[model samples]
Target: MASAAFEDIAETFEFLDDWEDRYRHVIELGKAMPPLDPAFKVPATKVDGCASQVWLRPVVSGQGPAAVFDFQGDSDAMIVRGLIAILHALYAGLTLAQVGQVDAGFELGRLGLNEHLSAQRSNGVRAMVERIRSVAAV
Candidate 1:
């Protein structure tokens, strides 16, 4: 399930008539997100398969599957950073168990991202999702 924060973004997307406006909105969302600390942008946090340099620092609250999941993310490219912000909205604050249940493709499709995102960007998103799932699984 998508988080409320993600739902809000989807709602906004519904009102944006053109892809350009939607892109602007996405970029604005990225701009609004707090920057991840430079210290955490290390090899361990780096996500592969992304054209841009990207890092995700997972923050779990508590132990086991019941733990809440969150992350601080960053990207060298603006659009990629915006994508990370979108992913954060989709997954942040969810329980580790709940994270596994989210249908990311379906949720992202609701925003019409599937049609607009480049092939590489879509793959990068998948890679990031895989990274998130892997961390939660551990």
Candidate 2:
């Protein structure tokens, strides 16, 4: 099951004026996620170009607006783990169109982390998006 809706995440970030608080919230989200099986963390699902080791497993169901997509992801870095959790909260169980509709840049910008994120972290997240796009396309 998904955590709080992405809307709730947005609201929480909006209410948290302090960046540290928002970052803490995201970290907590990551901590709450159940660990993935070691068997699923193979090189085949590894995300390329990430500064830290990361893996994503995706499951797609139904079709069109009725589609539901869920992903399990993990990262060796704590913050990256949190970022992966954010993606899952926002996208898990959503339709293919809904997944395509996620404006991650805008969302992060709204959360005020767009300018604050390091280039490497940003690139890692961009890779995450590309991976999600590819899986959903299939």
Candidate 3:
């Protein structure tokens, strides 16, 4: 399920008629995110299958399934960084258990991202989603 923040993004996407404008909005969302610390950009946090270098560091609060799930992500590519922000909006603040239940594709599809992204970018997004899910699963 999408979070309120993500719903907001979807609403914005709906308001913006042009794919170019949506693309710019995504980049702007990426720019708005705080940069992840360089130290966290290590191999351990790096997401595989991404065309661009990307890292996601999980920050769990509390314990067990009830723990809140949050992460800090960064990317060398601006659009990838924005993608990370979108993922953050999708999964962050959710319970660690809840994170696993999110249908990332369907939620993202609501914003029509699948049609706009290149195949590589689509794969990259899947990789990122898997990374987030894996972290929450543990």
Candidate 4:
């Protein structure tokens, strides 16, 4: 899944000459995300302060120290899904501490996403980071 996500991002970056194309590419990627089960849908899982309805579920494996997140959302919020994919790449297989150490906001800037995003979208990204931090703290 991580590899596929990376490949998607790489392909999008390579194919798109402008932000509009990139956004369309992102929307296509979002379409590829498997739908979340209805059972996991809950208010507690909903990310607060987002323009869209974002759901995040954490799975803590007994064999590992890290928590893996299963994310889903309503609305055709492509950039949000892409943002989630980025987070998955950074912290999916890491220990909780290691995941916590990652500077997601900085990484977003480094990846050139922060520069392209609107204030609301940027705030949503920050909210995601805060949510991840809270989950890691548990």
lDDT for position 22 in model 1: 97
Candidate 2: list runs displaced more than 4 Å: 1-4, 63-65
What tens digits encode model 4's per-residue C-alpha lDDT throughout 1-138?
Answer: 233455456665766778777776666666666656767668777788778767766665443445454334433376677666666555565566666677776655545677788888888878877887787767
lDDT of 3 by residue, 60-127 (tens): 99999999999999999999999999999999999999999999999999999999999999999999
Candidate 2 or 1, higher lDDT: 1
Candidate 1's residue-wise lDDT over 18-117, tens digit each? 9999999988888888999999999999999998899999999999999999999999888888999999999999999999999999999999999999
| Best-matching candidate per lDDT | 3
The runs of at least 3 residues in candidate 4 whose Cα sits more than 4 Å from the true structure, single-residue gaps closed, are 1-15, 63-76
Worst 10 residues of 1 by lDDT: 25-34
Candidate 2 TM-score, C-alpha based: 0.90
Collision pairs in model 2 = none
The lDDT for every candidate, in the order shown, is 0.94, 0.82, 0.96, 0.64
Q: What is the lDDT of residue 111 in candidate 3?
A: 92
Q: List pairs with backbone clashes in candidate 3.
A: none
What lDDT would candidate 3 get against the real structure? 0.96
* Arranged by TM-score, best first: 3, 1, 2, 4
Model 1 segments more than 4 A misplaced: none
How well is each residue in 108-135 modelled by candidate 2, as lDDT tens digits?
A: 6766767767899889989998899778
